[model samples]
Target: MVQRHGDEQSHVMEREPLLSGTAQPDSDYHACHSISEEDTGNGVLKPVPEEDEEQSIGRGETESVKDNAHVNVLKIISVMLLGIFVAQCDGSILMATHAIIASEFNALKDSSWLIISFSLAGAATQTLYGKLSDIYGRKRMVIIAYTMFMVGCAIVGVGQTMWQVVLGRIVSGAGASGMSALVSVLITDLLPLREVAQWRAYVNLVATLGRSIGGPLGGWLADVIGWRWSFLGQVPPITLAIILCSAYLPSHTSTVDEQDAAATDLLKKSKFSRIDFKGAFLFAALVLAVLLPIELGGVSIPWSHPLIFTLLGASAILFALFVAVEKRQAEPILPLDIFHSKDAILSFFILGFQTAAQLGMMFSVPLYFQVTSNPRPSATVAGAHLVPAVVGNAIGGIISGSVIKRSGRYKSLVIWAVTCSSIGYLLLMLRWHGNTNWFESLYIFPGGFGMGVASSALFISLQMVIDPAHMAPAVSFMYLMQTVWMTIGLPAANAIMQTVLRRKLGVRLLELGYDSAEVAKIISDAVSDVDFIDGATEKVRNAVVKSYIDGLWWSHAFSFSCSIIALVLAVFLKQRRLDGHKSKP
Candidate 1:
């Protein structure tokens, strides 16, 4: 049992030291339960004064202590949010500037690879990071992730070729995967599921801010100092985040006493072996196989290509083998047992579908403005239009979190979130034609808002249904599903857009008296480069713009359908009341 008495105080009254047991150590439980003792430097444990403790307790200062603890936790979380901000900002920056960077390298058609590389690397390593953190400790893993991110930034900043930049992104994505998963794990460590929801709202707010500003910031940097500086500039703030985390973050407490020489030696010898390397490798392979095909098909190669079919086949086989391997492991990278809960399964799909729809809109809205606007706005101006969506997202997160924290209910919020997103997509499908007013552009706001609410509510709902012991793995799995769908959603949207644009633009060009060969070349160029439309005649420009609008409408229609599916899933999601204790529905 872990006892909490006052601010920054925790005492674990365990019958036996965890390290000495034959069974695997319950690191999560130990993290929550371990005692805190001040070392005198002379190898003596400095104990708290009994009278002082009694006096503090006797004064009925329980609420005061709780308040102080809450404030302290907020401070820690605030510092941690800086890292989240940096990661989110980097993502949005790339989203906004990738076209420019790819064009610089004359690889405009390959720009989608940058985001796909990141998502692929991230999805592959997400659960591995969570499992590794449980072994090596969160602080260590987080700092390592930050260092990796910095290294990736440096590589990208200096990269002369697009493939080098892509390699850098893969590295950065791995680090980002760790950062995203570990930070949430740290928060869940600090709070119960109920409070986690409330604080996560604040996290979402910071992330939204990062994403909102990053687009404009990235575009400005790309214009002023070139795109390379955009990557280089993030290093300093990330370094500061590392330093702050080192200085202020709590140290990981071991399950064994420091004075226990044998246990310490045993732990040092066994930590690496504890990692499920086989499961991790198979899982990563499975993800790469699955996502690579999705990203490459209809972009780099034909959809009917043998390589795509082969990769898909390999992915299916790898998944089965991975499942079989994981079931026998004592400490699987992804604790598959969590899926035994109906709520966990439902939450995963709900989150996946919602995230897919939201990301599709996020990628599409900016492009829609760039392609369809009469003046042909710069990347900065196009990116600025997303501010409303980000703001709405932040607001939705705060509202959902506050409601969950107060009312201890989230089912209705989940429903409302999907509904809002669906409505947003529907609006875009109907109203965002070749020309859209500023107000009409704000149609994406509700989708962003819905995403925020889903982010907080679905997570808390997942936590409520699982055993506390499975929290870390469960959280990692949720992220895996999310990132996997993100990988699928973006490419899927792009494919749909390209397919529609090609077909519509070809038909229009043919009607305009262009020969079949001329129409094919024009369609190819238009699909490959958005700038192709800029040099066209008025008639051709209108045709290109109208074709793009048609493509966007179809994309929005797809997103709307996804949102409706998520809403249906949300309706079936089981609700459990939060009462500040771990319990199943």
Candidate 2:
């Protein structure tokens, strides 16, 4: 039960009794209450009068209202899941088709931008979506996100140039960021912390299904119809999701303190002024400056280029300015105060490192199979290999959710999650050499499983450690770190692969008595075209494959390092009680 006091700005959440009519101890609840008492000097819990409570519980009208509210919550969750499915499915489709689409326009070297542009745009706007939804209402934001995603899909379907497709991806990514962040926020709003893990497992299951189907489905569609059709096919589902959200989602704003409400009413004429546009702009600029340099440097341009230095310098300045601007705003896009907690800071970095490792592997593994497998599998065959990992991800989430729900503990799960991912990456680094067996490919399953478990444990732990008022911003912040790192990790892994492959392949060709010009040409063609190995001489093909294996070894090493770091950080996360009842202190 939650009670709102007009004078107190904080929320007091009570623990529900167990089924056996026994109350469980809740240390965090008592800690919060103690803090409230120390601050206000009169944090007293009020009990309802027995007669009044009986009358309220006895009313049939109240029971009917309760039933209606429960039904409405179910309706909201059902529609929201559809939207989550669309966003996740579309992302996986792009992952499968990105190389094929980029090659069509002979922009294979620039294919990383296909994903980077989307992530860049998403990371820039991710945190702002939370604050905007708080002011404008979640339903409106959902409709807007759905419309933008649909329009972006339409643009990509009809795009005539690679740049146009990239532009569409930017738009779609912005909408997808919101759809993903808001769903988690909404789930938190509707459920207690203990239950959040269980529901999140369902969300992960849906996401895994989308990813599992999307890879093969996208590849098949690209092979049968055109790659353009892959983008076009997503439009109808997103449109339906948009309509459902507009019709079924409630249009309620967040509850504010009475004094704050009064202040809002007074500023009704200038409500738009309250938005921290300066902070938002600075943050967007900072993200772009930071990511663009990372994505383009040492690939499109030399790392030592003047433009790279300029962008890095600008990013530093922008970061300082963004922090300053946010500190002054009453309703900042990101609540800087959330970082005050040790747990909040640790959770952000843990999420970043884990996501970077997981997504980096996802970006690389499909290409690894296509490049290294015997008989040279088609795109569809290559994509289908990820099914084991997806299934593992779903199973891991379910198990972690069940364990957390029953045991009311997550710290151990988090440690195990990172450990499993580290071992998975270690196997990849050690075992995935040229012409790997089909069974050996199952090495990625543990990594996927670990990520799935981390998703639930980390999110629930973050919620337990922060103030309830910071929930929305904190959730968005977590996603922002995730997207930012993903954007960096994918390209970094690719860059490592490219760097290693070029040097290794070029040297091998040179030692084989090939001319410098021929070696350069062969290396260029091999990296840019996956089909090059199929058409090359046997000796050249072997060399190219060996170089790719060496590069992948380094990439997997990077992921393993990240996972190990996350595991170390997980050890320091302070455990909190899941149940809401006061402890027996």
> Per-residue lDDT of 1-585 in model 1, one digit per residue for the tens?
222244524443221111122112332232222122233121111222333555667545644544555665665567778888989999989988898989999999899888888888888888887677767666677888888888888888999999999999999998898887777776776654567777888887888778777877888899899999999999999999999877666555435545545435656767778788899999999989998888888778999999999999999999999999999987788888798988889899998999889878877887999998878898667867778778888998898988987888888899999999999999999899867886787888999899989888998888777655566678888889988888778877887888898899999999999999999888888887788888999999889999999998889887998899999999998777676444453
Question: Taking the tens digit of each residue's C-alpha lDDT, what string does model 2 give over 102-178?
Answer: 99999988898888888888888888877776556556677788788888889999999999999999999888888
Worst 10 residues of 2 by lDDT: 18-27
Q: Model 1 lDDT vs. the true structure?
A: 0.78
Give each model a TM-score: 0.86, 0.84
Clashes of 1: 0
The CA root-mean-square deviation of candidate 1, after full C-alpha superposition on the true structure, stands at 5.2
